[model samples]
Target: MFDTIDFQALRRIGLSQALVAQMFNLQTEPADRLMRVTEVQRDRLRLHDGEAEHVAQVWPTLRIALQMQGESLVVGDWVAARRDDSLGDVCWAAARVPPVNHLVRRDSSGLRQVLVSNVDTALLVMGCGQDFNLRRLDRYLALVRLAGVAPVVVLSKADLLMDGGASRAEAVRRHLSGQVDVVALNGQEAASAQALSPWLAEGQTLVLLGSSGAGKSTLTNTLTGLAAQATGGVRGGDEHGRHTTTTRSMHRCASGACIIDTPGLRGLQVDADEAQLDAVFDDISSLAPMCRFRDCHHEDEPGCAVRSRVPAGRLLSYHKLQREAQRHEMTVLDRQRQAAEWKARGRFAKAVSRAKRG
Candidate 1:
């Protein structure tokens, strides 16, 4: 089925020569079609093969294997699917094409959840109004950096902010200090969407992440020049927007960039390591070498460049994120130890029962 797709058409959906080569080498049945996952539902998936769109599902066995491997089919995933021999209209996803990069987060239960895969850029959207939160933006940037994707801070609702949101954008830009791109724009305007055109080049994929009232849907509509995703207004008093996007979906833009729209996340926990946090705060990371102690926390330590040089608020936020990452790591370790202890107890009880029987 992939034989009919041309290179130009495939490129529009983020397929490259290297990815095509990988698909060709996959040991799947000849009848299987190579497709990109555009949307994932509870029991079904929407896929595009550069020629047409199809609804597909993973078979029982393949689904079990996907779960066992700790992998999931999210937006921007390329997969191999076979047309059901018995059912003419049905297609079963046989295998997934390995992603070059993926953005993920830990849930309250500590399970990892995949957001978007094979994405080149992450548009960290935040509104200029009450929806803006620097602490949350830091978390999003850390997660995107952890996945090795370029992060662009998108300040939406520019029309609502004072001075066309210039002052606010400058403040955020200064806080970041040339670390990442910060674009402030009205999501409803075409001119604003043009500001983001640089990242929307052909063969590229960008995912939107933000809170419910952050105007992600509006920006997506502006980017695609189509109301592909729904939009809603924030509450009158608090400006908290109702969740406009309930599911993750991808759309191809006129510029040939694939954009993935995600639901406004209420609880975004960055599941990152120490190195990932350092990359997000490179300024502070660079100062760590000048600290007096090798493992200095930078809390009242002598010659602590991080604490002395960086702004107090920014430094505190960095420390908070680092501690958060450390806590997440420790939580995983503790869970593993607890599981081992339970297994040992089970074995000891079994041995005692065997001795009693003897």
Candidate 2:
């Protein structure tokens, strides 16, 4: 299905030519085949092999090796697998190719969860109406930036409203520091398909994320030129959409790029390092260095550059994001401590068992 793949698209998505060449080599080999993961069950993966697809259990050794490295294979990862000689109807994964990029989010308990792997572009889908939230966009941007993936903000359902009529798309562009591209489009329109074509080139991987009823599935279907994903209408009074897509799935674009469509996220916790947060809020970072005191909180501090530039609204937004980042760090640290304690307890139990046996 992905015959006319665009190498340029792959490059734009951050995949090196060398990596593509390696994937090509795997595809050429008859003994081992490369497959894109579609669904991840408890212990088995549902993978697509271009013409046919199947569910196969990974070799125990491969799983252990990946776990040891503190990494995991998520949906949209390219894996090399072959039929096991000893087991019938099972495939043994010999290797997992390095991901070009990944999109990660922290769960409620502050544990990092891989939303999707090997993503080339993260389509930040947001409704042009009431669902437009710049603060939420900041969270998504932080996550994508930390994952080393490019982000494209997509303002969906634009046709329903007037063009550039003081919408959320304009607000997002104003607040975001970097050259983040924002596209406002009506997913049902043919023009929307054309606008998103550049990112859908062969070997590229794109993942969509937004709140429920943000037109993510609709946009996904539009990009593929087929209604492969189901759609639901927004709520009666609010612009919020019902949860339409429950699972993450990968689809191939006409240009040979792959797209991962994900369910709506109720809350997006920022689990990125200070470097990424600094990159996202560069305006704040640049101002901090000029603060008279090294530990200036920008609150009633003399010669605080951040406070000097701030209007009431901008200052509030800046403090909100800063506090959020601090909270995220604290939560992550707590989770790490809990994990360490559990590991120590396990070691103690093992030692006691050995003594008892002796």
Candidate 3:
């Protein structure tokens, strides 16, 4: 099915070398062909075979090479590969390309985990019913902004808001900046699915994120025109979605774009950098430069530009986003300090071991 994939699109998504080799069916001659990786499992990878698809296991040599380079591969990466005589098949592989962009998060252990590499856009999906939360959207925006990808807010399950009252879209617009495009539609409707086609262009990679039962799987099924994923209903009392998607899976849309569906995030730990926080609170950042004092907190500062606009309501939203951004920045700093201390202790232990050996 991949015989006609757009090579340019593959390059744009940043496929790693080893996976790229398998994608082009060049595992037998790694030096000759390039392939892009569509998905990855613990020990195996699903690669595009130029026109079809194939699976390859990570060879020990490639694994060691990745470790040596301190580069971990993720989905949406391109790679190179070659056959291994010892494995009795074209099993050995290597990552030849590095990612142009990657979505990374700090795991509980303080290690950086790449969620997906080379994504073009992030679709922040939120259900219109009781699942909509402005603070949660702020968190998603901060996370995606750090990755340097475009963000689109998708208000799913719009059919639920058909009562003719204040629309869910209106509620979302109140919290979002006018610069962000907001799409409200029912995933079950074909017309609604078509609205998202422009972003699903061939070779592009988009990720769907929201709370459980926020209609991510439903939207995925609509876009793919098949029931490739399972869906569960929301809880009767709370209107919360069940954990229907158990794993992260990448699917190729008929339009040639790649879509990654992740399980609903129950808790989003703040693990982004100060730059990301600044991006999410751009209005505040802009005002900070105008403050009379460089260290203006905006609370009672004499020449606070941010505080000046708050009474007129122009900066109320900005102030709220600024507070959330500050909280996330502090959290990230705390995590980094903890990680540094752990590394220092490990080094100290190794030094003591060397002294004993001598």
Number of backbone collisions per candidate: 0, 2, 21
Residues 125-186 of candidate 1 have per-residue lDDT tens digits of: 99888988887887888888889889999988788866888877887877777678888998
Mark the 10 consecutive residues where model 3 has the least summed lDDT: 24-33
TM-score rank, highest first? 1, 2, 3
Q: Which ten residues in a row are the worst by lDDT in model 1?
A: 1-10
Model 2 whole-model lDDT (C-alpha atoms): 0.74
Assess candidate 3 and give its TM-score to the true structure: 0.75
TM-score of each: 0.88, 0.78, 0.75
**Deviation in Å, model 2, residue 127 alpha carbon:** 0.5
Q: How big is the positional error of residue 321 in model 2, measured in Å on the Cα after superposition?
A: 4.8
- Every candidate's lDDT: 0.83, 0.74, 0.69
Off by over 4 Å in 1: 1-5, 331-358
lDDT tens string, model 3, 16-125? 34344455442334242345566677878777645656666765666787788656666666656554567663443464455667776655555556777767889999
Residue-level error in angstroms, candidate 1, position 316: 2.3
lDDT of 3 at 22: 50
Worst 10 residues of 2 by lDDT: 1-10
